[model samples]
Target: MAHHTLRLRVRRITPEAEGILSYELVASDGGRLPPFEAGSHLDVHVPGGFLRQYSLCNDPEDTRHRYVIAVQRDDHGRGGSRAMHELVREGDVLTTSYPRCDFPLLYARSYVLVAGGIGITPLLSMAYVLRRQRVPWHLHYCTRSPERTAFRSRLVSSFAGRVTFHHDQGDPSQGLDVKALLATRTGGTRLYCCGPAGLMRSVREAAILHQWPREKVHFEAFSAEATGAITDRADTEFQVVVRSTGATFPVPPGRTVLNVLRANGMRVPSDCEAGSCGTCLTRVLEGEPDHRDSFLPEPQRTTCRNMLVCVSRARSRKLVLDL
Candidate 1:
C-alpha cells in the first residue's frame, strides 16, 4: 500500500512516567481520525527526517476522537524518541502515515500477553479488545520499577486480577522466570510478546525448548539487533530485476535491495527497516533469498516465495521481483 501522509495536530502531550511521554493526535480541522485496529500503529515523521512507528494505545471501538501513543526516550536509540521528547510539543503539526497493524490479536482459546517497557503500547490495546469480547487473557508487564512503569494505575485498576507486574529493580537475577511461566500451560494457549531483545530471546528460547507449536507463538520486535548473520554476511553485490519494467539495478555492498530500488526511483512501502514489519515485502518471482528478516516464518522462508526487501538480500546472483 502507498504511504498515507497526513497532517495531524498534537492535541495533548503528558508525561506518563520517567522518560516517557504520551501524545494525543487528532485532525487539524477537528474532523474524525482514521479508524484503526486494536494493535495498529502510526508512522510519525518527526524532526531529523526520520519516520518512527508508535502503537495506538486507545480503544479501537472509539474512533471518532483521537489517536494516542506513548514515546519512551531512548538515549541510545536513533534519536527518534529523543526528538519526540525534546522537540515535539502540543499544537505542533506532524506528518504521519496511516495506521497499520502487523501484530494483530488472533483467535485463540486463551492468550498470554507479555510486554516490556514501551512494548506494552500495542498489547494494552489488545487487552481492551479482549475484555470487550470476554475472551480469556492475561498480561505480564515488566519494567525496572514502579517509577518506570507507564500506565500503571490504569492497568492495575482496569484489568486488576488479569495483569501481572514484574520489576527487576536493577537486578537481573530477580527478573521474571520465563521458563517457569511457559512451562505452566503449553496447550490451548497463544503467546504474544513484544519487548527488549533479552526478554524476547528468553521467551523464544523457552518456547522452543518446550516444543510449542510455531503457530501458537507470536512476536513483534520493534528494534533490530546486530547479533545475527544480517550483519555478519560478506558484503557482496547483487542484481534486482523489476518484472514490469524489465529493468535491472545493481545492489552494491553495504546497501539493501529496497535501498537500491528506491535510489533508482522505484517507490516501495517500508515502515520498520529492521524487517520486523512486513511493509516492504515483495514477491520473489525467482532467485533464492538470504532471509535475515525475523518477520517471515521459517516455513515461508524455506519456500522462497517472498522476502522483506528492506533488510533481506539475495542469495543468488540475480533476483526477479514483482515490483
Candidate 2:
C-alpha cells in the first residue's frame, strides 16, 4: 500500500525524567487513528533531522480521541529524541507515518520481555496487550538510572509483580538474569527484547548457546548507527547500476547508497535511517550486500540477497540494484 501521511496533533507528550509531565493533544482530523497490532510503531517526522519510530504506548483497542507517545530527552542524541523531548509540545501539529514494526508479538503460553532505556516504549504496548488478555508475561526494564527512565510510576503501580525494573547505572548486580530467565522458561514460551544492540546481541547469543529456538526469540533496537570504521574503510567510488533507470552515481566514501539514490530523485521509503527498520529494504539481484542492517535474519545474510540501502553497502564491485 502507498504510504499516506497523517496530520496528528500532539495530543500528549509525557516525560518520565525522574518524574512525569503530562502533555496531552488532540487529533487534527478528529478521526480514529489507524488500527495497528501490539508491536506496531509510529514514525514521527522531525524535519532537518530524522524520522524515528516510537511505539504506540496507548491501548490499540482504545478508540481514544488521539494517540499517545512518551519520550525521554537523551543527551548524546542526533536530534530525533532531543527534538521529541524538547521541541514537541501539546497541541502542536506534525506529520507522521502509520505504525510500522519489526518486533511482532506472537502467541506464547508465557513471555519474558526485556527493555533497555527508551526501548520500553514498544514493550509498554506488549505488556498492555498481555495484561488485557490475562496472558502470563513479565518485563525486565533496564535503564541507565532511575532519573532518566520514563513511565516509571505507571509501570510499577499497574504491573507491580509482573515487572522488574533494573537501573544498570546504579548497580550492575541488580541486572536482569537473562541466562537464568531463558534457561527456566517453559517450552511454549517466547521472549521479546528491545534495547541497546549490545544487550540484544548478548541475549541472542545466550539464547542460542542455550539452544533456544531463534524464531521464538524476537527483538528490535531503538537506534543503531554504522561504525565510523566500517563507514571509512570502504571506497565510495563503486558503481551502483539501477537496472530499471540505467543510471549510476559515485557513492562518497562516507555516504550511504540510500542517500545517493535519494539525491538522484529516487522515491525510496525509509524510517530510522539507522538501519533498524526494514523500511529501506531492497532486493539484491546480484552482488554481495554488506548487510549491515540488523533487520535481516542471520541465516539470510549468507544469500547476500536483500539489502537495507539506508546504511549498508556492497563488499564487491558492480552492485546491481533492483530499484
Candidate 3:
C-alpha cells in the first residue's frame, strides 16, 4: 500500500455548526481515481506539511468526487487543524495520499455502529454501506453538542430512525447510555466503534464484561500511538534492510525512516504516522527495537520482534528495519 500524492482542488466550508468542510480532490493525473471501500482512509499531507491520516466519509462508490473530510478546530498541536480551518480552500491544492485503511470491516451478520465527535469519519461510510446493502444495523452518534457535529441534518434525514444522536452540553458526567445499550446482546452482531480513548476503553471493557466475542468487537483508534521518550540515539545513519528486495539504505536524519524509504521510490503502506494503527509494522530481524507504540502490548510485542518504523526510532546506530 504505497501512498499516492493527490491534490485537493475545491472545498465547501460551513461554519454554522462544528465547521463542516468538504474537499474535492483528484489523483496526480487529475483523472478518475481507483475504487475504495467503506471505512477506507488516506494519509493526507497536513497543511503545515506533516503526514497525518483522515478517513474518507464520502460514498466509496462515487468516483466522480474524491472525498468529504470534516476537520474540527483542535486547539492542540502546532496548528494542523487551525491551518486546515484557515488556509485550505477552493482550488488551493494540498498534498494527500491515496486511500489506506487499517480498519476494514469483515463481513458480519449485524453491526452496531458508534461514532464520537470526529470519530464519525470512518463509521459514516460504514453506516451508508450497510443501509445500501440492507444489512441489519443501527448507528449511535455522540458529540459534545449539535453545533460540534459535522453532518447533523444529513444523518437525521437520511438515516431516519436507524441512528441515535446524543448531544452532551459540555458535561463530562453526562456520558452515553452504554449500560442500557449493551444490556441486551445481538447474537450474531459485531460492534464497531471509533471515538475518543475513554469511549473506546469503556466500550471494550463493557463488551468483554458482557462476554462479547473477542473477534466480534472491532475498533480503530482515532489518535496515534504515543511513545513516551525516545532513547538517546547516536548520530550514525541506521541501515534499513528491505526484507522483500534484499536491499539496504541509510536512514536519514530530520526525517522518519518511513520518509527515507518513500523518497527512495519504495511504496511502503502507511496511514497514521503515530504508530498506533500497525499499518507500518515490519519485521525486525537482528536489532532490539525501543518499542514505544500503544498497539503492541507487552505479551504480543515480545514476539515483534516486528517493529513499527514510523515513530519508533532506531535504538542502535546501524539498526536494521524490514521494509
Candidate 4:
C-alpha cells in the first residue's frame, strides 16, 4: 500500500544537543495531525529529494496540533542529515509521510529502556507514555559525553530517579555493561533497546546468553547497514518475475530489486531504501528471499511470504512476486 503524505509547515527549530536539532512540524492547513504511538517515526522528505526517517520524540498524547522530530547531523554519513541541517529553516514547508511504528512499546510488568546517542529519540517518546501510564520503567541513556546527550535536561527534570545517564567519553568499555545489566531476567520485565549497532548487538547477544525470552526483547536500528543487514554477505545475481505480468527482470549483484523494478517502469513506492522502512514490502508468490531487511519481524522472515524489495534479494534463481 502507498503510504500517506503530509504537507507540514516547520513551526520551530531548536537545538537539542551539540549537533542535534529538533523540529516542530504542524499541518500546513492548520488542522489536527493524525495521532501516533510512542515509537512512531515520520519519513521526512528533505532537501535534494532524499526521504529520511526521523523518530517522533514528542509525547504521543500531545499530537493534537504538531509533531516533533530530532535530527542529528552526521558529517561522515550520507547527505540527508547535512541537508536537513543546512537547508531547512523555521517557517519552511516540507513533505513527510504519515507516522509509522515498528518499535512499539509492548505491555510488560516492568520495562528497561536503553538508548545510545541519537537513538534516544523514539525511546524518549516511550518514556512519556510509560510515565503517563504509570508503568514501572527506567531509562539508561548512553552517550559519548554529557555535551552530546540530547534532551538530557528534559529527561532529568521530568524523570528524576527513573533515568540514568552514562558517558563513555569515546570508549565502549566505560559505557553501560549491557551483559551485566541483563544478567538476570526478571519475571514480567521486557527490555527495549535502540542505539548504535554495537550497543544493540550487545544487548541482543546478552539477552540471548542470559536466556531471556526472545519475545520480551525488542530493537529498532537507525539503519540496516549498521545492523549488518545490508552488508553481512555478498549479493548474487537473481531473477524477479512479476506474477501479474509474467515479465521477468535480471537482478544483478549490488543492485536492489526496488531499483530494478523502478528502472523497468514499475511504480514501487519506497522511503528508506536501507530496508529499515517497510514502504517497499512486496508479497512473494514463489521462491525464498534472502531477507536482509531489519524491518521484518521474525515470523515474516521465517515465513518468507513477503519481502522488502529495497534490500532483500531472492534466494532462488528466480522469485515470483505478487507485484
Candidate 5:
C-alpha cells in the first residue's frame, strides 16, 4: 500500500504531563485536513530524519480542522521523542503520513479501555466517539503518579464518572488489578488496551483465563521494546527469496529482513521498524517465521500466512516471500 504525506504546521504545543507534550497539527495551507477515525495514528517524519508513530488523541470528529498527538520523551530511546521535544517548535512545518488505524474500535454493548502511561493517546479518541454515541464504556488509565498523567483535567471534567485513575507510584504491585477486573466476561463487551508490554500482557492473560473471546480483546503496544522483539535470542544467518522478483538475499545475524531488503534497493512501506506497526506486513509464500511482532494476533501467528519483516525472522533455513 502507498502512503500519502501531508505537510502540516504545528499550531500548538502543550505540556500534558511530565516528559509528555501534546502537539496540535493543522494543514499548512490553513484548510481542512483529512478525516480520520478513532485509534488512528500518524507517522511523523521527525526532524533529524527519524520516523515515529504517534496515536491521535483528539476527537476524530475534529480531524477535519486539526490533528492532535502526544509525545512522551524517552531519554533512553532512539531520539525521536527527544527530537520532537528539543528541536520541534510551534509554527514549524512537519511532514506526516495520512492517518492509519490498526486498533480500530468495533461495535459492542460496552467497552473497557486500559491505558498505561502515554498509551492513553488512542484510547482517548475512542472515549470521545463512545461518549458521542452514548455507549457505555470506562477508561482505566494507569500512570506512575498524578503528575505524570496526561489529559488529567480533561478526563476528569469530560469523562467524570466513566474514568478511573490508577497511580502505582512506580510500584507494579500497587497498580490496577487487571486480573480481578477482567475476571468476569460480560456479553457483547469488548476490551481495548494500549500500554507498556506488561499491562497488555496481563490483560491478555486475564482475558484468556476468564474465557473472554479472542475477538473481544484488542491491544496496541507503545514501543518495539514493549513488544519484546528486541531480545537476547541469538540470530542465525538465513536466506530470503522474493517470489515476485526471484531475488534472493542473505539475512545475516543481528540484521532484520527489512534492513536487508532496503539495503538491496527494495522499497517497502514501513512506519515502526520495531514491528509494532503492521505497515511492513508481507505475505509469506513459504517457510515458518520466528514471529516476534506484537502486531499479529495470536491466531494469525499460528497460520503463518504473513510476517512483519521488520523484527520477524525465518524459522526455516529459507523464506519465500510474496514481496
Candidate 6:
C-alpha cells in the first residue's frame, strides 16, 4: 500500500526513559490524524534526508488529532534516531508517512507478548486494544533495569498483574529465561516478540526446538543484519527488465535493484531499505528471485510473484519486473 505524506507539528517532547524520547505529533492544520491500528507504525522523515520507522504507541480507539511515537537514541545507528533526538523540537514541522501496520495483530484466542527495551512501543498499543476487547493477554517486558524501561508507570497502572518485568542489571545470565518461556507454552497462546538480535534469535531457536507453529509466531526486525549475501564473493551481476517501459538495466554485484531503478529515473517509494519494511515491494513477472527480505512469508517468497527490491536479487541472469 502507498503512504500519504503529511506535515505534522511536534506538539510535545518528553523523556520516556534513560535514552528514549517520546514525541507527540499533530497535523499542521489541527485536523484529525489518520486512524491507525494497534500495531501500526509511521515512517518518519527526520531532519536529514533519511527515513526511519517508529511504532505508534497511542490507543487506537482515540481518533484524536495526534499520533505518538517513541524513539530510542542510537548514536551508532543510521543517524535517523540521533537526528530526531538532537534536532527535532516542539512546534517544529516534520513530515511522516501515514501509519503502516507491518506488525499487525491477527485474531488469536490469546497472546503472549514479549518485548525488549523500546520494542515495547507496539506491544503497548496491542495491550490497550486487547484490554478494551477484554481479550486474555500478558506482556513480558525485558530491559536492563527499571530506569531504562519506558512507560513503566503507565503499564504498571494499567496492566497490573498482567505485566511482568524482567531486568538483567547488565547480566545476561540473570535475564529472563526465554527458553523456559517458550517450552511451557499454554494452549492457543500466540507468540509475538520484538527485541534485539540476540533476544529474537533466542526466541526463534526456542520456538524451533519446542516445535511451535510457525504461523502462530510472529516477529519484526527493524535493523539489517549481516547475511551471507552481503559478503559473498560469488555475487552475480544481473539485468532487470521493466515491464512498463520495456527498459532493461544492468544490476552490478554491489548494487540493489531499487538503487538501479532509482538511478534510472524510476521514483519508487521506500522507507526502510533494510528489507524489514514492505514499502518497496514490487511484482516479479518472470525469473526466480533470490529473496533476501524477511518481510514476505515463506509461501510468498517461494512463488516469486512479489519481491522487496531494496535487498532481494534475482537468481536468474535476466528478470522481468512489473514496474
Could you estimate the TM-score for every candidate?
0.74, 0.71, 0.72, 0.75, 0.76, 0.73
lDDT of candidate 4 over 290-311, digit per residue (tens): 8877678777787759998977
TM-score for candidate 2, residues paired by index? 0.71
lDDT tens digits by residue: candidate 2, 1-323: 11577788876665566533433435597987777777776666654445555666666676356566665555554455556666777778877776665567888888989887767878888888899888788898888777777788889888889988777775645676667767766778888887766566667767877888866878765642211112223233466789897897766444468778987999888754555557789987777766666667778778657888876767777688898
Clashes of 2: 3
TM-score top scorer: 5
The TM-score that candidate 6 achieves is 0.73
- The lDDT of each candidate is 0.80, 0.69, 0.68, 0.83, 0.85, 0.80
Q: What residue runs in model 6 are displaced by over 4 Å at the alpha carbon?
A: 1-3, 223-323
Per-prediction count of colliding residue pairs? 0, 3, 0, 0, 0, 0
lDDT of 2 at 257: 86
Whichever of 4 and 5 has more lDDT, that candidate is 5
User: For model 1, what is the error of residue 6's alpha carbon versus the real structure, in angstroms, after optimal superposition?
Assistant: 2.2
> Which scores better on TM-score, 2 or 6?
6
- Where does candidate 5 clash, by residue pair? none
What's the lDDT of the predicted structure labeled candidate 3?
0.68
Residue 82, candidate 3: Cα error in Å is 1.8
* Clash pairs, model 1 backbone: none
**lDDT tens per residue, model 3, 1-323:** 24346666554555535554655565545667767788787666666554456677877877565676666666553355666778777667666666766677778888898888788888988878888888889988888888888788888888898888888787745858775677678778988888775566667767867888877877765534213322333223467777778777777432356777787898878644555567788778777665656558777655657777765556665556555
Q: What TM-score does candidate 1 get on C-alpha atoms?
A: 0.74
